[model samples]
Target: MTIILKEVLESEKPILRNLYSLYLHELSNFTMNLNLGEDGAFHYEELDDFWRVDGLSPYFITLNEKTIGFILLLERPFLKKSNDYGINDFFILNQYKGKGLAVQAARKIFEEKPGQYFIIQVVENKRAVAFWKKVYTGLNIETNERQDLIDKELCLIQTFKV
Candidate 1:
């Protein structure tokens, strides 16, 4: 499959916002256990907050111009001095999962967006932990894997200079 990761444009906000609900729905499976809003909406307000964040780059993961997922890459990693980038959020639709599309998209994104990367996954999300391990390993680079304490919580973080 030919996959592309294009930076989300302001004119595409509605399209991106539509995908926002799906992204959050997929993440509902996380340890965070998302709960729907009263109006049955995914409360897309968070998207606005993320957009307003400095150094945050949002992309629409598309397969032939059809949106399938979204990725929020933080140009300024949380641990400022430790790593230069971060994946604040990432999600692919259920039907698209396990198809190796993400890994391919990530490779392209990594190539286009270069930096010392830092990725943090909640310890309880074994799927994320496993997925990232595979992605980094696929990168064929030396990575420093460690546990990090962020916002009074423990998370598994991998740091690597790409």
Candidate 2:
């Protein structure tokens, strides 16, 4: 299947909401092995803030014209220690797991928009911890921790230098 990553548009708001709802439901049910709760779901207020942020961009991941996941990138501050871009959110349908679609999508993004560093924060739960470890190793990435957040115990902050 051909996987495509494109910028989210205003006309696709409904589809975005539906996809996000599916993700939120999965997270809420603890089906995806993530630690996020209902509070993690995107809300209208968050959407408004995202729209107003010039440094943040939302991307939709599609396979054969069907949207399967999304990724949000938040650019770094000009004076940041690392000129890395953050992967704010990356989610794929449960049915599509283990297909390496996420790796493909991420590779595409990195190729299209190259950066020196790429960061991803994964919840420190069983499944996610394992998944992120494998991803980091398979992709030859280096992992680290960010101590700024109070919830660091529940989160694994990883960074990759490309």
The numbered model that scores best in TM-score is: 1
Best by lDDT: 1
Per-residue lDDT tens digits of candidate 1, residues 43-143? 56766745566677889899988888888888763336766788878888878889999898889888887888878887867887888889988889678
TM value for model 1? 0.84
Candidate 1 regions exceeding 4 Å error are: 76-80, 149-153
Error of 1 at 90 (Å): 1.2
Model 1 CA lDDT for position 140: 90
For model 1, which pairs clash? none
lDDT of 2 by residue, 1-162 (tens): 767998888678777776766765654443334344476654433654456667677789999888899887777552266755777667788887788888788777777766665454445345655766677677676666552342333455666665
RMSD of each: 2.5, 4.3
Worst 10 residues of 1 by lDDT: 26-35
Clash number by candidate, in order: 0, 0
Give each model a TM-score: 0.84, 0.75
Give me candidate 2's TM-score against the actual structure.
0.75
Question: What would the C-alpha RMSD of candidate 2 be, to one decimal place?
Answer: 4.3
